[model samples]
Target: MPEGPETHALADRLATLLVDERLTHVRFIDPGLQRRRALLERQRVLAVEARGKALLTAVAGGWTLYAHSHLFGFWRFVDDQDALPDGAPPRLVLATVRGVAALYAAPSISLWRTDELGAQPYLAKLGPDVLDPAVDARALLAHMRTPRFARRTLAVLLLDQGFAAGMGNYLRSEVLFQAKLSPHRALEDLATNERRRLANALLDVPRRAYRAKHDDALPPGKDYLARTRAQFGFEVFERKGDPCPRGDGRIVEDRLAGRRLYWCPGCQQ
Candidate 1:
């Protein structure tokens, strides 16, 4: 599945090409979405925003188009002068005077009245968006401290959208590694300092991944590593059997929360 950062990147690209452009054509390959065609036709795109792993496109017509590229789904965009790829037709297509955007293999596409967007079931249940600059670190910590959350393992907790929206497999592993906390450990097992470190990493890791992906630069204060051209990139994710960055045990992988988690047990413990 494309996580929050990937979805954000896609939204950013689509915004640059689609915003302010009038929708000349709209097609929904899904029969259920055919009714929404009229809502966007001749309407101008006002903005494109990302919420967790979903993309929301606001239209001047007072409605928003929401697309969630669930597991195995993706998007493709072609400029006005360029030819769209020849292949299986995408599940959804939105055409503007400036460009064409198609969503392939995506499973969820809906149109909602702009004023009623907050009532959408998926958006309404999401926790604080980690990428939001105004996210309160303390509030995040408090949310995890509640009785319903305090006993869950960090691996499972991080994957919970109700705990922190935007975290996926890679983000969870990397963040826990940075926090030097074991994925098997529950919140109740953490010391005060460990909880503080984890609270900060939960916010920092995904934001860093977003910046590294979209901006080609490290997050502020992150330094470059000699091994990879990417700055402060993954220290343990997918580095199985390789030497740990901390210079102790080889990186290892194990199943946690139904996802493969990579970490250096030598340092993480």
Candidate 2:
């Protein structure tokens, strides 16, 4: 699944290609969205933005096209040299004089009035977007102290979109590892300094990922003492049974929050 960083990068690329361009044609391969195709055609793209794992295309009218890639969806662009493929599923193709931007295999795509964007159920519940440059770590800390979140394990809270949108399985594991905190630790159990570290890591890790994806560099690893750049990426994610890069212990995996959680027993204490 493409996480927030990848989705953000996709939005940036799509904006570069489609912003300010009028949609010459709009094609919805998904049956659900087909009815709205006529309404989107010839609408100028005002901007393209990413929220969590979803993409939003603001059009000339008051409508914003929302598409969530979910687990297996993607967007592809094609020009004169590169041709659009045939038989892609649930694709919403937006074409202009320059080229075509086709969203393929996406699970959800629909139209929302711009005025109602704030009222959208999913958007309404999300916490501060970690990708937002102005995100307040103090505010996030306050939100976590609420009754609904105060007693949850870091494993669960880290993956909560309502706690911090844009966090996925890999990021949750890596952030905990970076903070040298165990996933089993509950938010209420953490000390002020520990909570500060966790909050900072939550914001820092994903923004690093956004930069790495956009700048074409490797995501920073959890092993802070790593000697070189090559050694400084993804300390615990997908490295189960492998020796910890931090040399504290072997990396291990467990299930948490309905997803795989990876950590090093020796280092993440």
Q: Report the number of the highest-lDDT candidate.
A: 1
Superposed model 1: Cα runs more than 4 Å off: 216-232
lDDT of 1 by residue, 1-269 (tens): 87777777777788877888888889898887877698899999999988999899999979999888889778888874247677777888888877888888746888899999998888998988887666767977787777878889898998998888888999998999889988989898899899889988887788767776744644332233112223447789999999988898898999988899998888886
Candidate 2 residues 63-131, lDDT tens each? 898888888887778883248765644377788888888877746877899888888778888888777
Model 2 alpha-carbon drift over 4 Å, by segment: 30-32, 80-82, 216-232
> Cα lDDT of all candidates, in order?
0.82, 0.79
The ten-residue window of minimal lDDT in model 2 covers 222-231
Compute the lDDT of residue 34 as modeled in candidate 2. Answer: 80
What lDDT, from 0 to 1, does candidate 1 have?
0.82
The estimated TM-scores of all candidates read 0.90, 0.88
Candidate 2 residue 179 C-alpha distance from true site, Å: 1.1
Clashes of each: 0, 0
lDDT of 2: 0.79
